[model samples]
Target: MAATPALEIAPEKVAHVIIKAREYGAKVGAWNASTEEGDADEDPSAILEDFASDPTLGEIAGFIDALNDDEQANLVALAWIGRGTFEPEEFDEAVDTARSEQGNSTASYLLGLPLLSDYLEEGLEKLGFSANDVESDVL
Candidate 1:
């Protein structure tokens, strides 16, 4: 069966979602960088287990250490929306924009948002990395 059309998310919500995305990414990097031995694309989960139990955690720290101010902001917004941290109506607007622009619903587009380290972590999770741990230290 064909999929039903998704409701649009708003600009305000989109903005917030982007921030979360950045945060998630940054946290993952941070976790990885904290380790004595850095993780790579291949089998990074093993090292993550030793470092923070959550593989994506490294990317958060990594983001803070590596990304510039603007890039950081963008990623955070991605996570915010991904996790539903936006006003209902606003989120709808953004989703609508995303659908028209990216040919997919806002949530899906957020997941696939370019330049998001968190998005990369999502892929890692698919590879068996855990993205459950939340870093209270992260702002």
Candidate 2:
């Protein structure tokens, strides 16, 4: 006999997860810098790079990277919505709070959020999760 499986969740669901995670991170002040208003013409990657370089922020990014594909998606959303500077001390506290409240890392929390299928699919693939696996509970 064949085994039945849980239906794969939708890609939008995955995107939603990312959104939630970002918002949570933002509210907790998980920003990449100390200020929001920059040169206005500065490159975004530079900011991310800066964040990646900071000891605390870099640790956070590593944490973000550790999240499952679903978490990765939401981290993107969080970044989209919560762009700008963040106080590391405050952000650290928030990360702790987010963890207690969300029951997962900020990134993983967002992965369960809703988002466009195409984006979610691509995100999952990037995170090393099979898009098909996302469709079901195999993973």
Best-fitting candidate, scored by TM-score: 1
Candidate 2 residues 1-139, lDDT tens each? 2322221334445544434333334332224466643332664433333332234334444555666654443434323323322222233333334444555555443333433334445545543456565555522
Model 1 alpha-carbon drift over 4 Å, by segment = 1-48, 51-60, 87-139
C-alpha TM-scores of all predictions = 0.27, 0.23
Number of backbone collisions per candidate, in order? 54, 17
Across 1-139, the per-residue lDDT of candidate 1 in tens digits comes to 2332232222233333335555444443334455555455665553323344554434434434354433334333334444445332343343444334444232344445445545433422332323442222222
Q: Which ten residues in a row have the lowest lDDT in candidate 2?
A: 80-89
